[model samples]
Each structure stands twice: as structure tokens, then as C-alpha cells.
Target chain A: MHAILDADYLCHLGFIRDGAPVVLPTLYARVAERLYMHGSAGSRPLRCAGEDTGIAVCLTVTHVDGLVLARSAIHHAINYRSVVVHGVARQVTDPAERSTALNALINHIVPGRAADSRPANAKELAATAVVALDLNEVSAKVRTGDPNDDPEDLALPHWTGVLPVQRTYGTPVPAGDLDPSVTVPGYLTQR
Target chain B: MHAILDADYLCHLGFIRDGAPVVLPTLYARVAERLYMHGSAGSRPLRCAGEDTGIAVCLTVTHVDGLVLARSAIHHAINYRSVVVHGVARQVTDPAERSTALNALINHIVPGRAADSRPANAKELAATAVVALDLNEVSAKVRTGDPNDDPEDLALPHWTGVLPVQRTYGTPVPAGDLDPSVTVPGYLTQR
Candidate 1:
């Protein structure tokens, strides 16, 4: 399983409103099994699209940076990477399918979470929507490492190096009113 | 200073090529301050007759999922929130001004790391492109806590609660073949 590079990069399946696709940033998750996402079968936009328009899906970008390293000026390069995915999402109309998909997404966030919390009842199920898409046509672009210094600059006295950039999560400050004894779960503490 | 509620939303900054607007993601950071993102210089789309058009951006997002308590279904209501800032972007062209803007960005990612790393040299500066935006037009949305079930399911008794999602960082794995005795820094340990 690939580590989730960033939470903001999570692609939560969404439809084009009026015209363009709308992606929500917090949809990214990591799973040992196939990654699952939210798609709605009855979403107003999905149901109205004609055959020519085709099933629509969009991805959300969470993080991007143009890193500039220096030794000399001319050898500079833009060191960056990103995630992109394309898919035709179909809303899962069947009840059983919705429940399973929701669980998969919950587990997609953290395995065993669905069990610890209650499963969706009929109404809750209806309240939620699930968009299903084949886990294909996905690609990730990653770039790392240091500045590309010219051979001539190798002996220069000036400093040269990479500026490390990454996302850092703070201690999970539980809901303010949460009971003090509700220990910070081990999974969260691991961060 | 507002937290970008959702960085997944994409918008056209200006006209480029056919209809493309240099398609960039919604990922943003408020480096100058937590919420001082006001950079609106002009109004609406900066259309440039025959020349390329640009935008005056000054927006951001904020998502906050508040605490919720529910004894059973129907009694549950979530307390969550998020924000999004959509607007045009401005290119920081002035030499000194551009440098200041970029340095803010570098420090935003790593507190003291910017000071610790080597500064960009002159030739390197020309290669880097920097953009600034304002925090004017924006929106935020949120969802939180338990599911609303019919009054009947409350007595049926399946454990009911909220599932939280979080992010984590793993131990930093260094590049191989380096000195093994290099001590891990305190900043990393805090991470």
C-alpha cells in the first residue's frame, strides 16, 4: 500500500455543478485494499447527464509547491510533484451496495472504525451518497531530491542544498468537551 | 489566516491556450499570518484586450468540525465546518517584493528551516515565479458527528457514535550511505 502523501490530495468523487467538476480536499485516504470514494447515484448532476456528456468524475488537489534550490542561478529547477485521476462515477443505487461502500470508505479512513461505530440505518443510509468508479486510469507524479548545480559551480564556496517541505500533523486535540478519560487513541498517538 | 476549508476546488485564474487557465490546484497556505490573506488589488478578471488576462486573488478556506454528542439516532447532529477562498492571483514581479513573498512561503512550510537553509542566489531568483492572491470572495462548509435515525432505531441498540479521521507522519527515513551517527534533530522528534 502506498503511503498517503497528503490529506489535502485526497480525491472525493464529485460532479460538475452547472459545468465544472467540484472536488473536496479532505477525501484522500490510504487503504491496503482498493481505495474507495464517495459517489452519488441519484445526485442531481449525475442523473441528468446524457449519453454524450458521459459519467463525470473529478479529483481534488491538496498540496503543491514550487521548490527553488540554489547553488548558482542558471541551474535552478522547479522540483514538484502532484496526483491526478480521471474516472466516470456512477452512484450506487442499490441499498446493500451503498452500505458496503460506506463501510469501505469508513474503513478506507481507518480499518475497524466501522465496527467501533454504528452502521448506517435505513434513513442514515438514504442521507448519504456513494459514487462508484473503476480503480483504473489513476496516476501519481512525484519529484524529489536537490538542486541541479552546474559542473562549474561544484567548487563554489557558497552553500547549496534542498529545502525540505512536508505536511506535519499536530497532537490530536480531542473535541474540547470530550471526556478527559477518553484516552488519545493509539493510532492517533502514533503520529 | 483562515484555514482553507477545501483545497480541492479549481477555478480559472485567467485565459491560457484554448480555455485552459494554467490549471492549478486549490492547495494554498497563509504564510504571512494565519489569516492576513488580503491581496485584492484590482476588480474581477483582469482582461488584457489581446494580451493574456489575469486575476486579482485574495481568498482562502476554513473547515471546522465542532464537537457533537448523541445518545442515539435522530438525537445526533454533527458540528463540522470548512472554508474556501476563490479569487484571482497576482504575479509578484518587483525584484525585492518577489523575494519577500517567496521567503514567506518557504517559512510557512518550515518555521526555522528557511533561516537554516541557503538563500537563493541572483540567477536562481530570476528562474523562480511567484504569485500572490487576496482573501476576498470565499466560502466554508462543514459536516460532523452522529447520524439521524428514526425514533424507533434508537431503542434497537447497535452501538452508535462518531468516527474521527486524522493524519499521521512516520519516522523520517534518511538517505542511505550517510554517517549513521548523525543525531535526529529536536524539531523532527517534535514532529
Candidate 2:
């Protein structure tokens, strides 16, 4: 399957130091064959639990597994996963370099989306901000599949099965101002 | 909308804390008009860092968005949204009310998934464990879109539109061992 680094799948990436969580809504990263963000401006939406806000940065992403329906209600469970990165996030300041970073940001959220959208203008660039965090300290953890049934419950007359869950996409709705001649991109058709 | 508490849905909930995440395969919970999980056997998933060992737990759920299609690209993004809770989960081990708490968990996840599924037996009940948190803090964030565009490019006249995302459950596959005589329940059919 072709890979997509979408905002919806990306959990918030976070960093915590000295008992605090540093939220970075947009910390560009690459893992295996994927990239992700917390969807929105992570840093912009961060609510710090500490007073000393110098230059803290963190990365976090989550995947949801609805629930595990077991024969015995108590044995029922959930399957899900997530990752978090803790470290220092320095703001990007170089003008030429920052512009390139913005493209990375756009592409990171929707690969090739940068080309579909306009490149940031000088003023827009100034308004936009980027943070670079070294992925030195990171963690990935996951829980997958059914509940651990007791050796005895195996014989119960109840029905036992897993309800597989999958996300689907629908037809696109064009922007109101879109030209009447505009046709929806096929790429968007599947989503 | 009816507030139904599904034990399955509550069991699906997990969180990250202390930088490491601990994900339980299953936990008891309730599903009502709104979802709620009482502090119990839950442990902080992010108790450590690095690999699976460092992650105490990770919470994830996928809400289906429709399907995505790109004439030129196969890269598809699920139009769904999810939230991850990471933190330290202390077992809710009060000797007295654990049973009621377990029922709460069932109702919270699926409103009636617990009642629909088999109930916990005696030995199973004694073995059942619940995780709880004294610091009940969580956040909900989301995103929705087709594609973003630059102001000037709007006049360029390239076909631009948003593919809406939706999730629809397929026919429920029943357990093979069950009696074919039992038809699917009303909730399962409409859902």
C-alpha cells in the first residue's frame, strides 16, 4: 500500500523534561517509511503544566483500537498503540532554510500537498514558525488483539469473535469558490 | 442522542504517562450518553522510554473515514480522528467496590457490549484487575479536510476539491460455532 503521512493518523508528538510535557504540534519526523504530526499546530495548542517555559519540546502520536469483545465481559479489552519523544526543540530561524522547512511541513501532513497549495509568501513565512527536535530519546509501545481468557472460560457456550475495524474515505466536496470547471482530484476520491 | 455506556468502549481506553506507556489488553469500563472510566487497575503506559520496554502503555482507536482515491496516486489517508492517553495507571484495588467498577467499565465502552457478551465468572472475577488514575486529565483534538490551497493559485483553475471521509461497518461476521438459527440482533443490523 502506498504510504500516507496524514494528520488524522499522527498523534501529538511530545517531549517532557523536569516533570513537564513539551508539546510540538509540528515536529517533522521520519520513522521506518512514515512521517506524522499531531494534525494541528501541536506547540500552538500545548497546555504546559509547568511555569519554566524556556525551550521545551516533545513528540507524541497515537493509534486507536476500538475494543476487544470477549466471551466474559471482564475479559473484554482494547487494542491500541502510540509513541512519544522527549527532548529540546529549538525554533528554526534561518530565512532561506525556514522556507524549505515549511514545504516539508506541508508535505509531511499531506505528501505532495505543498504543490497543491501555494508556497508560503514572505509575510506568510514570517508568520509561520518551525521547530526542529533531534529524535535522540524516543519510545514506541503497542497493545494488539483479544483479551486473555481463563483456561476454563474456553468452554463457555457464548459466541466469541473480534470486530475488525477499518477507516474509510468518501467523495470530495469542492471548495465553494472552486471554478465550475474544477474536477475533484482522483487521489482525493478514494479518501 | 442516547447516552449508552458500553463496557467494551471503556475497556478500549488507554493512556500515556511518565514518558512510558502501559497498555492493558483489556480493562473494564462503561458506555452511556457520554463515555467515562473510573480510576482502577490502569497503569501509566509511558513509565519509561525506548522500544516496548520503555513504554508502559499506548492508547489508540481508529474512527473510519470513507475511502480515498487518487487517479495518479494510491496514497490514501483515513479521514478519521483519534486520541491517546499516556500516563501512570494505578490499579483501582479498593476491596469493596471493584465489582461495581467493573460493570461501569463495561457500560462505558459499548453501552451494552458487556451485557451482550458473557458476564465474568467467579474465578475470573477474582483474577480480574482494574487500573485507575487519581489525576483524571485528558484532551480531545481533531482535524477534517480535503486539500488546502494557496490564495493566488485559486485562479490557476486546477481541479481542486475535498474528498469527504466516512466509516461504515460491514456485515458482522458471526462466530462459526454458534447456532445458525440465531439471527443478528436489531442493534447489530442497524449499526
Candidate 3:
């Protein structure tokens, strides 16, 4: 649950269309056992999927923790955690549910962001299409710790360890055209 | 070119099989204009793709730079830079090129790792299958700066700014079975 919720970037979405595979990277939000995503109403997948029939889709998120430097090149590997979900995606048509899904998407990127931002207007809501995928078949795979090197190769004169990778918050940059009076948000500083 | 080279983590690989789309997350290295990857000899994509005949593939790498907190939820967005490459992937057979490609993969994760690690043995080389995709049809999209909020919503009592995201190298953790005499590598400390 934590791994799925903590993912910060985009999700690689896979689906089939016209007897060929198509994959897209898009922003995603998790609500209960469902993942929500929004795109332009005219998007290819959304149109081809047919609002009622839905489409078969697969979503995956990955976080690389470190590089496992082993004594032997053959044993070299990366420490990572990943989650994959296979499900059918259907469009969200209800206006209220769509707004909630949209808010979930915003807050997923930055907590408390939805409350701070204005709700979508009628026109904006009409232009956006929301899709939901139920988390039925989901799997998480994680690899941690150090590299597994060969016993004979250990004595070789070589250095080996794990170089950790971390993602952190950098200094906030306000909009250039903003009013000078507006200050940086407190939530931004907490990160 | 910069976006493709500067990516820090994994790449999302997409391909079609049996009229369905399949997407996988894998480590990738870029050498000149060619992207290299390795997998088991029996892997689905590798075996199904065939050795001489290539498979149509799409590779994408993304770096999230910031969270765009807007005054309105409808305008909320993420600041990111991503590169997408569409091409045919072919197997690498020549031993010399295979060795070079493997080294490129190692050094891609950790700059000086290839020199520090032992070269792959003949058996290990036989077990691994390397593939390369040329960077011909590639495109990069970037969104930077701050959120674009509506003019009417500015006066609303809400905070808005860009929360920057940065990925950095952390302290290296030594292997549990590592010999005490072996110290952390200097190249890793530099990161």
C-alpha cells in the first residue's frame, strides 16, 4: 500500500488497440482499491475503449533504491521496488465522482493541494475525461540489501557496496508573473 | 539529447505480443545514439522478438522536477522532462559489442563501476541476451517553472508555488558479508 501511494512520478499504462500494443505515461491517483487518471476527451485510448465496454489495461510503478555494485559484472543488479496492476479501465461519468477523482489526482502529487486550489468549473470538467482501474490483480516486487558476489571473486581486489538513491524536495520556485505579495506555501517548506 | 542522457532511473519499455500490449520496466543505457538492455535468454520479449528480425518498441524515460500547485485544481500540473523513443530493437551477437554494451550499462548506473567490477565470464555472457534500439524517432517534452492559475482565482486566499523535486545519491551501505578490509569505493563517495 505504501509503495503504491508513495510513487511520485508517472505510471506506464499499457493497453491494446487495433490489434497492436500501445503504452502511455500519465499521471495517476489511487483511491481505495482503484487508480484514476485523466486526459483530454479526444485521447485515442479513451475514445477507442468505448465508454461502456471499457478497456483492458496494465499499470506499473517503480522506484529504484540503489545500485548493487558486485565484485563480478555478471552478478551486478539494482535494488528496486515495483508494483503492477492488471485491470479493466472504465470512464467516470458521474460529475460528483469525477470531481472527487480529479481532487484525488491533485492531492496525490502534493497533499493538501486540492483544498488550497479552486474546484474545477463546468467547462473544464466537460473537457477532461476520467478513467478508473480497479485494483484486482496487483503484485509488488521489492529487492533490497547488497549485491550477491561469487565466493571465488570476493578475494579479487575490487570495491563493492550499494549506492543509495533518494528523491528530495528542492527550493520552491514561485511563478514569475505572480503577484509579489503572494508568499510560498507552508506545505511546500515541510517537504 | 540531454533529456535522454540525464535520466537517473529505469525506462518503461512497451511492445506488442499476440495482439495485446505488454509493458515492462527495465534498466537501460544509452551509448551514442543507441539504447542497450539485457535480459535472460528465455525472456518473453527477447525470445518472441526473434534474433535477426526486430520488434517494434517504444522506450520512455522521465524525470519529475516539481509539483505545480495552482490556484485552481483544474490547472494543477506537474513539472517534468521526458523523452520518448520509438524504434525497432535488435539482438547484439558480436562478443566485442556485447561486452562493450554490458560495460555501458554498468557505467550508466554508476559512472566508474565497469572498471571496478570483474568482466563477465564466458558462461555468464552466453546466458545474457543484449538488445539495442537506435535513437532515430525520438522526442522530448518538458514542463518547467510554476503553475498557471486563473486570473480571477488569484485573489482567493490560497497559496501557490512550485515544489521542486531532486534525486541525490545517499550513503553507501556495505554488503553484510563484505570483508572488513574492503572499504567503500572512492567513486561512490564522490556521488
Task: State the lDDT of candidate 3 residue by residue for B1-191, as single tens digits.
Answer: 65545565478888876655667888889888899989897898877555567888888787878888778888888788888878789888888889889998988888888998899988888889999989998888889887787778877767777878877889888877778888888888898
Write candidate 2's Cα lDDT for A30-79 as tens digits. Answer: 53433322222233432232123424544555445434556677666555
As for DockQ, the candidate ahead, 2 or 3, is 3
Task: Estimate every model's Cα lDDT from 0 to 1.
Answer: 0.44, 0.45, 0.81
Residue B121 local lDDT, model 1: 71
Best by lDDT: 3
lDDT of 1 by residue, B47-159 (tens): 22111434433232333232232333223333445554444455556777666655555444333434544566766565455555555655667666455545554444333
Q: Model 1: how far is A20 from its true place, Å?
A: 6.5
Residues forming the 10-long window of minimal summed lDDT in candidate 3 chain B: B1-10
| TM-score winner between candidates 2 and 3 | 3
lDDT of 3 by residue, A68-152 (tens): 8899987888888888777778889888888889988988887777887788888888888899888888888888887888888
Q: Which ten residues in a row have the lowest lDDT in candidate 3 chain A?
A: A1-10
Instruction: Kindly indicate the candidate among 1 and 2 with the higher TM-score.
Output: 2
Pick the winner on DockQ between candidates 1 and 2.
2
The TM-scores, chain A only, for the candidates as listed are: 0.68, 0.70, 0.94
Is candidate 1 or 3 superior in lDDT? 3
Say which prediction, candidate 1 or candidate 2, comes out ahead on lDDT.
Answer: 2
What's every prediction's RMSD, in angstroms?
7.5, 7.4, 1.8
Relative to the unseen true structure, what is the C-alpha lDDT of residue B124 in candidate 3, on a scale of 0 to 100?
88
